[model samples]
Target: MSKKVTGNAFDAKIFKRLMGFAARYKWQFIVSTISAILMSIVSVAKPILLQKIVMIYFENKDKEGLLNYSLLMILFLLAEVILQFLFIYIVNWMGQHIIKDIRIQLQKHMLQFKMSYFDNSSVGKLVTRLVSDTETIAQFFGQGLFMIISDLLKMFVVAIVMLWMNWKLAFIAFIILPILIYATKLFQIAIKSAFQEVRIQVANLNGFVQERVTGMNIVQLFNREKIEYENFIKINNKHKKAHVRTVWYYSIFFPIAEILSSIAVGLLVWYGSLDIVNEGITDAGQIIAFIMMSQMLFRPLRQIADKFNTLQMGMVAGDRVFEVLDTHSQIDKTGKVEAKDFKGNIAFKNVHFSYIEGEEVLKGISFNVNAGETVAIVGATGAGKSTIINLINRFYEINEGEICVDNQNIKQYTLKSLRKKIAVVLQDVFLFSDSIFNNIILSNETITLDEVKNAAKEIGIHEFIMSLPNNYHYNVKERGAMLSSGQRQLIAFLRAYVSKPSILILDEATSSIDSYSEKLIQQATDKITRHQTSIIIAHRLTTVKKADKIIVMDKGRIVEQGSHLELLHKNGYYKNLYDMQFASEVA
Candidate 1:
């Protein structure tokens, strides 16, 4: 992905995109804004009320007037607290709702992306976009946007009150304002760069951890633990350094802001004392009120810097997320034809394809499978065996081809309906962390537990399932880690069988299993493929001997294709492969 040239904390384009999520909860935001304004007004009134009570009622020994003024102050303070609560609650509510909607839309968009996108993208990075990045956008709404507005309002109101009370004192109090603003601007620029680095490191760390943990078994088997640990430490330290840089910026900024705030207060006292002694223009009550107002003004100046950081981080996150949302790699499913009446007749005419440009995996390969025909494709590694099945499912668009089903172009069929009628069982079967029943039926209401049990019986894996402690309700754990490879393959078979697909494609389905499991899988395969158009890709010649037709592929082209007996009699590529395998087994 290309780097986004972000402007500032108030980057209008990025912030506007973020507010699109907020606009959905405009009423709540409006309420929160009103609450913030009310709090600001109440806060501004309290200090002025203090000045009045001190200058008039307390100084005159007017007990009744002082009591009434104190009561009014108490009421306004109470109102301030209530409004603050509402502002916080409503802002956070809006933030959560906005993030929920964003996360849902982000995931929905990713789900529509083609398999080619996933092939080139990092799963961990995508996951971070869905979870951590979206949470940062939430912070924009909950803490950054509204709180900045409220703080600015409070400062603006305080400035007006201070100027109205004593213009000369207000001028003295604001002596440090320009310096503070300059410091804030510098802090914003420094921290923006630091925060961008921090987010990049965070994504890198997440990707590293996810990949290493997922492949832990391979690392351990290859004895790469020490090397991998050293690499992880390096990534973790980079992540730590990125965060420490941000903290360093905060450390420098907050202390400077505090010193400026103190200087402003000291300036007020020093200048006000001079005005009172030399000119008698200001009194003790007005000076005290000016002190309070200065704090109100400068403190928000300090806080606005922090809130601005929050807003900046949120924009950075939004930029990354919007990149995913804006990706247009989704496979087109706008075909007018539905697969409701699919006949399972598939053909690939002069099909040419490549994952990367100019490196064709399948070079103008042409073949056809008539209705209910069982065709097995055999090839060495990287000969485009799996690519064919992927193409048939429309996981990746072909570079140049006419893939047709029942004399109609496959591209003319809606993807969902087309895929629903076809089922694929890959060599590496993946099961969710759910019960075996859910894994088989995939939470489909149409297939019941009893139906799954019946399908398991039909595939001869019913006894194996019943042998487990929880029977069909047993959780398979992540990727079916709790089960043996053969057992997982058995579940895959059962899943495909339950779908009742018009076309079944099994890619090396029984190649990695033991003889016992292979026997069971063969029986299941025979039952499932009976009278159904099945495409099987396998390396084991024994498995495909029973196939109706076997096609031998070499270097992205078919070397020979015929029935098992016919190919053997011809002594071509298929015969050579079968003879080599049979001899190796005998030896």
Candidate 2:
């Protein structure tokens, strides 16, 4: 869930950090800023030129002077147009380049985070941070900061000119200024809250839609379409309300600004006419210039309020993005040892672990597997069978205990080097939406097509793959949905075999396949595990009977460890489990 933004609408620290991304393109940023200032200075020249033409040329009927000043005003207008274009183009270019760098850095950081971080984080919210929030930050440069600076500069220059021309009329013009400024301040505060709510609703709406679409199959199977639709309606309604609240603020603020601007103009005209008649203090040309200056000053004051909201939204987005970047969930990769020629010997000594703090998942368990030995673990659900597989790979840090490989602590080896020596084929296989060959090689470039075909042939699934539409080039679609479950399992076996890892783990690899695929998997299994250290976690008792040794677990502890025949004869936990399966098969 997103936290509410508190304190000031403008966060200086976050703004500075966001600007740091622009340091690489400092030249472009500087050019844009200079262009914006030039544009503002150019904007003030038109009113001053009008005042000069009216005062000097109109009274004297100097046609040459009038023509010269008119031409000069045209030149300034053209210069302002060119400066405006440069300012917009350069700032937007800088924004795009900065966001690109930030996105790359953010993704790289996220890739190194620990698995536990992902286990608790929402995928949709992470997507929001990566895609939408970063885009908003980009607007901070393109539309918010530079534009506001230009508007404020224009207002400042116009205000100074107004006071210099006629002090009394300028004072009348600014009488309504304080009221407008206070109202703008109130509107900014109110709209900032509204924009924050809008952002939150957008994230919620994204998260809900993503989850529902990914689980559409389950929704259809369970007849939950109507219920889910109703839930979606509720979320969508809240999103609408949040946006309407922002619109409501806009609707109220702009009209008040327009009315106040009109009142400032009216006050200027009344005071200037009275001063001209009673004291002959001001002329028509000065009054006209002051009126123009009043508009120039108040226009940006109104626009600044709008631009300030844009700035505020960007700050909100920056806060959310930095929150993700600031997370300290990365795995420690300080181990310097490289497992160049890792042996497959493994040991677990009194290991303790838990996903949650208070509840223990693997409690004080000890086990060992000799080099090049094939071991099978059999147990019911939640018996810590798969947790052992996760521990060996260092997916999660253990609470208390030592896991050693090759008589040295696994922590001594770099994570990349250690994982490279181990290959896992899980029960629920996942394949990318790509060709069979690419999925097998996983874009490694080091593994050739010939190598993959040879591995498939060694696993005895080459002929099966050849029968597919495109052979090794067949596209499996997302999650291998185009292939049968058994076919996916065969592909997984080939993938693991091609890696040539020192240790191979098959967790229920044959659990849900047909008899033909199971036979093929068994042949592949025997071929691959013959000279490799392998761990097989299976529910089928028949598959483990020929294993060199079987470890039976119950509730996170090793209840029995022996050969299949020895455990069957002992009439222990393994005996009861084997008899129950045998009875079910006979019935």
Candidate 3:
């Protein structure tokens, strides 16, 4: 299903939620609002002062009276300037604070999202919400909202003043109000749809760019750079088109506003001349003041429309952000039991599971591992080997099974405590862009540098680490790209070793390791698995040779279970797997 780009116009629920963040600094916003109100009043007073000087003081031939009024006008101008600066600083400060709070809250909420949500969602789209959308919302608080309120108030005050000065001239000046209002309404509706399109295109462009950059190596390796570049240009053009539509609406609206404004001025001159010819109804100063007042009234009417667009854009962003915040897809962490001293006697009873419904991966499978025993699961690809590891770690909940550790249901233990008792080393290891030491210890205050070094030395990887520049402090770059595959595997092994968990999981850890590294890994594995419950999923089969028990699986069911030598004698699935590997190696 395609997603809608725009939210409800003037969504009170979203507006109230956004205001909740601004309310943290209510005193500052209140002070800025009061300043805006005063500025509007001061702005309206200037036209009156201009009228008094022209008619009452300038025409009287009194230089002293003119000088006094001029001084008062200067004071008002200076006061307006000071208040503008004050409000500008305060409003911007409050905006920054509110967005800072919002970004932090959004990040915290994202951290709680389920793994499944991330599995299907785009990282680039989420980034747009965190960075661009939140920034747009910031403009609403800093500039759009306050300017809109000030403009509306100025128009109101100017309207009253114009009527008081000369009701007939005000009537002639406001004759174009109906047309102006209709044009503005149409502009608002058109611009809103355009802004929504712009936002949607921006998100799509960001997603494309982020994914392409991250995987540029693969694109170049496959020699598909030209095709990818063409795809990017297509997306870029769509984004450009969305923005151009917005400009098109702006072009139409502003010219109409200017024409109406000029007509109002022309009407004032044309009608005021009749008043002068009919009788001495209005003076020159009042006529001039009426012109200035018309500008004050009509210009803000246009500005109010523009500022309302800013507000609408902010609401669109707020709707997107709040949708993520309101999602309730987090895993249930209600288990109260704490596995303080986990013995790791693992068992899976009648486990049936699937990544998708009605397509079972581990169907009616049962297995058991005694404390301190090592078990190896061997199978062809997609034969539920890795799925077993995932279920044991509870990365996904089983459809119909009870997985237990230490003779109690695994779900009975608190997730934090349960995971702390186990460590996993996958063949495709991932490391953060940090120092090797930090990657191994992972900021666990309890594991010091010395302990990490001791673990590395015991695992026989200390010499390899020391060979790098800066030794243990060497940066591994992103995803450990600086290291060889074997070196990264060794690092993963050492990382798991430092945790000192009761259960160790090695999912094809030696599949990509070189022969020399494999020897060291085998030695480390033998030592580590001696007194812990270990589960090894292997395709090479050689790595599982020394395992106390081997469970052979095919199509999500265990077909054979025995020692390495006994499995070879059975002349079954394990024997066929062994013979196939031996024949390929001999050839």
Candidate 4:
């Protein structure tokens, strides 16, 4: 999923919020500012003292003043070293703290987003957004903040010293300033383009690898090892090309900046030498001092040039992360109004829904399930059996009409209050990479070990868990790859039933369990569904035979609905469904 890049290009205004992100640890930034300023002051003093030592001490033989100036220069050098260290440390502290907050906030925001957000979003893109992209942005502010502040300080101090010591020489050097600025600006553009290319390629590479790693089982099952290997190489080649382009740009700019700085120094020395020869005024030390100062000025000019590339990459990544954080989910519970209790009465009134434009998946569907009744939705593949369950639970908002629970419109109730009473087990079960106990708990409050064991026993997987070396402590790998399909489904069943919801939706929940486990779960289901509103979407007709009401759906519409024996007598859609699964019907 390639997100359209909308990086706020080198905008000074965007950085205002960037500053706000750092405000949480602004004291560290203050310390960094002080350290950087002090360092700049000490650095600029040395060349002035050198010129004085040459003109007064060496030429006029003033021993006392020379020694004092030399001692002061040494002291300034020491101060510069200590302050530079402090500056680096403080800015780093500030940068790292801001990164931590941004990452945590990004995850929290991701959690609050609607389910559709994940449906359209890619896991690999999000991983890159959270990990590599966050790191790059953090480093940009960390190192880039120091470079900006420290260099601006050095430039200011250098300009002042240049004017005070020898205004004429300073004027000669400043003549080339416009040309250098133009060159750096153009070079920064080149590097920015290069960095953007690198960022895009890196994001693509991450996505490719993440998808492949996630679908490893599918790859092995189909015997597509060579195809997978080729896919990896294709992305690797793209990354290499991008990296080479970045390095190529860097190589050119570094040398060009160096040559320009040297030419400016050479011109200043050429002009300053003529004045010294004509008046016999300037000494060797002043020329050396001039060279040192020129180099000092260009050093940070070069750093800003290099760091601009990093800044560009960071901006690209920061924009991606902010997109997720800035989005407001379609479902929000901010109204402060809520349904106090859900008695399991679900009412759908003229509900119309569609997953795509110009095509209705559920059309003007109206139905009512009274409290504590068992409702089974039966349908062909394209029929809206799952869609109806989805609408009742308010997973997908209705396009037209309203759904009510316990006599109140669902939209008026807090989403938490609306969903707290519902538990759904989809055909595909997802388990986290945690212990079996935690997976059973499934983001709800932790349950007692006894409750976990009992839920497992109800699903008929308890004795099997104890048979393993870790039992309840057994580690379930990603999606429960370490366990069998039957084991995974049984565990997912416990996760749903243990919540004790007022309403239960089992969409082919027992599809994977063995005959023995199915028998056990059927027994437990009878007691659990006694007074709870149950909606079961069955593939095996016999599993839902005892449901109080059965509704048959076709082509996004309900074709027929009645009690099991009543539907069978009608010999309609449900009758054909029963005939199709005859073996399971009589099992």
Candidate 5:
């Protein structure tokens, strides 16, 4: 990926967060910095020590001086090796620990975001952000931080050694140094953008592949394999182009940087030898030191180039990571409101709501249900039936007015505490890939097997579990794909029962099941709702016939609401709906 991203994606705050998190490990970081300083000085000391050995010990033919110098150099190198190890180990450990904290915070923040955010984002992209992108950010802390420190220290040490050798030649060599640094930085920005494009294309490709593969059966049934393949090819080509662009940038960068450094080193050598011959004041020691100075300066200059390259990568990955970190989730529980008791009495007061603006789904909705009441919501598809229950559950905030639980406005309660009191078994049942017993009990490490069996039995799924080869210990496949739709729904019902909630909500809970399973569900519903406040949203008119209060809604408004017998007597919308279904069954 290119090192430089567009100015649009650049976020100073994200950079601050990244650096600040690493800064938390102050002691380890301080130690690493000290080690770099010591190492840089010791490194330069090697050449200085060599110079002294040659001039004083070797020239004078003093064997004792040579032996002492050799022993001291060995000791210095050993200490340097140990310090190098400590620097690497401390930095690595701190970076990983900081990353763990960041990941946890990112997860918590993402979970709080509104469901609408997810509707527009692909699950594959989100997964990549959480798992891969976060790791990239952590890597900047571990590798990038240490490299920058070592490079800068080496550069400073080289400058000092160069000044001590021949100040005039040293000054001339570094004249183009600022320009080289600036050019690399500019190239780094370009590289960052290239990498960002690559990441985006790759992320989109992943999303396309994941969704297409998961629904491969549908694609094959429709005979659209060729069409899907073409779509895949388009994204794949885009990714390839992005990678190629990055390569091209580096091709230009490395060569230009190499030429500049080479030219500087060539000048240093030519002038140093000329000055030695012409002035007669420059000695062999001076020439050797000048050569050493040339190497020291050029070496780190090359490394600084590579450091900027790594920085570009961090910028690209950081942009993607910050995108997720910046998102605001839906569940806002910042209010300090606490709800101690909800008596299962839910009321919607002048509630006005809409999934989209100026297209209200529940307009001026008003209703009240006392504790232990069974109220059924009957409406045609898109008649705002599900919206009613969603409002009561506080899944979506109403545009205007209040929804109260036990006369306390839901907004007045903390989201965590309020949601815990309600249980819902939706039509789209989702089961984890776990044993049947765990699926039912869900959190029964302490709860007994009898409780799991009792809940399953309540939903008439106990016998089925016992019949399984390993019973509750049997592992389920993804999405409970191994189980029948009815079986999955029954497990969902048992899961809700395990919560022991005051309010029970079933939004078309039995829509996909066979007749026998429907009867089993109906039987379970009857017993479960014996004394609980229940809300059933369904299209089957017969299911709500025995309800004490049956509400009929249409076009975002409740047209008629009364007992089933009362609506039938009036021969209104509900009566017509029931009669039409009854006539179709009879035919």
Candidate 6:
């Protein structure tokens, strides 16, 4: 989760990419930029107007001229304020819009990634990239990029005016500038590193907390509450230290900048007073204008240093976000063929797969199922039963061989088309935090409530559903936590059956349930699996006794295949499994 800061203090490539998100709002960006320029120009004008009011009006005893010029100075102040407000508002507005677009694109991209990409990545870290990192990039525009530009513009205009008014005094005032600039450069580099570490710590803390909260039940069940608390304290401490490092740089850099700024003002007054007394070339008004401009020049330079850190932090976040965007882990979707009027015939040819290199979960195994056939795959834990389901769904890429549905290679059909023809009921059924009706339909407008009710009636779950308060309209809550395990399984069966998939897979669908729920599920299963191409995976051999054919597996390889009686006669792996399960049931 802790990514290294390989980039420089400022990466031009990342900056340009971030700007591309603003293409739709170019007019607003232009207005903000123009306002910054105008604000700088107006800011420089006020100091000049003040100098004129002192020298031309007050010096000559012209009260009316002094009052008029003072009003003009007030008018310029008002214009500057208006421009500053416009600059701040527009830049922030654009920032929020840009980040909204980025987050949308990031989420859409993640949705397309292969399951293996998620298998190897952290959920909490992805959440940080999608939410926290994108927010930091928003500040890149609001506080970093445009604010730095505006401050630098003010400094530039003030510098030109200072020199134009009186070059000798301007040179004297600029004597300490080089030292401040050097100090600022050092601060930028140091703070950039510190901010990168801070971001890493934030991601780590988020990951730790998210995992802990999600698994709080497991922690409480195992009496790990105190241990988890201590672990949290350790991660929280690292987060604090990372932030304190950033503060450390701020504490050192700011006071040094203030000292240098005070020195610049002191030099301007010392030389200006000597000039007025010795040669009568400088007046009180000129000295006062130079002092104001000196503050203007030094203040923005210091502020620019601070803003540059914000810019650096944005770049760090941008780099992490773009790294995800740049990944080429999405499943290939170039297949143009549609699986219309699909047949239930399925075949696997010399298939081989490994979740990790050199450790195959499925060897070069091959099998075939005729249309409308019902087959069962029985295996011990880690025998690649679930991996076969994943492969059939194209959730991952195969390392070797091909899978064919309806006698055509699955790769020849679009992923959407291929998956649309198949339905799966997982052991751990996942229902959204929504009404039961919506969860069953899953946003498919084509399936009406009448159809869902009909499917439930045929599956024998209609009475069970109607018994609940609000019936089908009841909210299941997150992951269907409001319902029992058996209840969730019943919902999944209805969902898959209503889809009318050509191929149906029930992986351990009847395991770990009460007898009442199992009886209901068996009734539902008989209705859905009848005359449909169905593959069942179960540890319960008794459930597969009626399967037309059963494949027994151990340690990622098939050891036997036949009907229950045929395997029992052979006295092989399947018979031993059936005997052991029957003995356990009797006990």
TM of each candidate vs. truth = 0.94, 0.91, 0.89, 0.90, 0.88, 0.92
The whole-model C-alpha lDDT of candidate 2 against the native structure comes to 0.87
Rank by TM-score (best first): 1, 6, 2, 4, 3, 5
Q: Write the per-residue lDDT of candidate 3 for residues 363-435, one digit (tens) a residue.
A: 8999899999999999888899988888777777888979999889888888888888899999899999999
Candidate 2: Cα lDDT at 494: 88
Better of 2 and 4 by lDDT: 2
Query: Would you list the clashing residue pairs of candidate 2?
Result: none
In model 5, how large is the Cα lDDT of residue 548? 74
Candidate 1 global CA lDDT score: 0.88
The per-model lDDT (C-alpha) reads: 0.88, 0.87, 0.86, 0.79, 0.77, 0.88
- Per-residue error at 303 for model 3, in Å? 3.6
Give per-residue lDDT, candidate 6, residue 579.
Answer: 73
Candidate with better lDDT, 1 vs 2: 1
Report the number of the highest-TM-score candidate.
1
- What are the per-residue Cα lDDT tens digits for candidate 5 across 191-223? 767866777798788778988999999999999
Candidate 4 Cα misplacement greater than 4 A, ranges? 1-9, 52-57, 60-71, 217-223, 227-231, 267-274, 334-341, 443-446, 583-587
lDDT of 2 at 202: 89
| Model 6: residue 155 alpha-carbon error in angstroms | 1.1
Clashing pairs in 6: none
| Clash pairs, model 3 backbone | none
- Point out the higher-scoring one by TM-score: 4 or 5: 4
Worst 10 residues of 2 by lDDT: 1-10
lDDT for residue 96 in candidate 3, whole number 0-100: 83
Candidate 6 per-residue C-alpha lDDT over 1-587 given as tens digits, one digit per residue, 9 for 90 to 100: 65553334578899889988998998998899899999989999987888888887647978888899899999999998899889999999998999999999999999999999999998877998999889999999999999988998898889898889999889998899999999988887778778777877987887789788989999999999999999999999999999999899999999999999888888889999999899767887888899888889988888786688788779878999999999999888888899986778899898999988899999987888878878999877898888889999899989999999988888889999899989999999999999999999899999998999998888788998899889999999999999999999989988998998989998998886778888877887787778889999976655687788888888878888888789889988877777776556744
Q: Model 2 over residues 84-188: C-alpha lDDT tens digits? A: 899999988988898899899999999888788899998877988999889988888888888888888888877887788777888888889999999988887
Q: Which ten residues in a row have the lowest lDDT in candidate 1?
A: 1-10
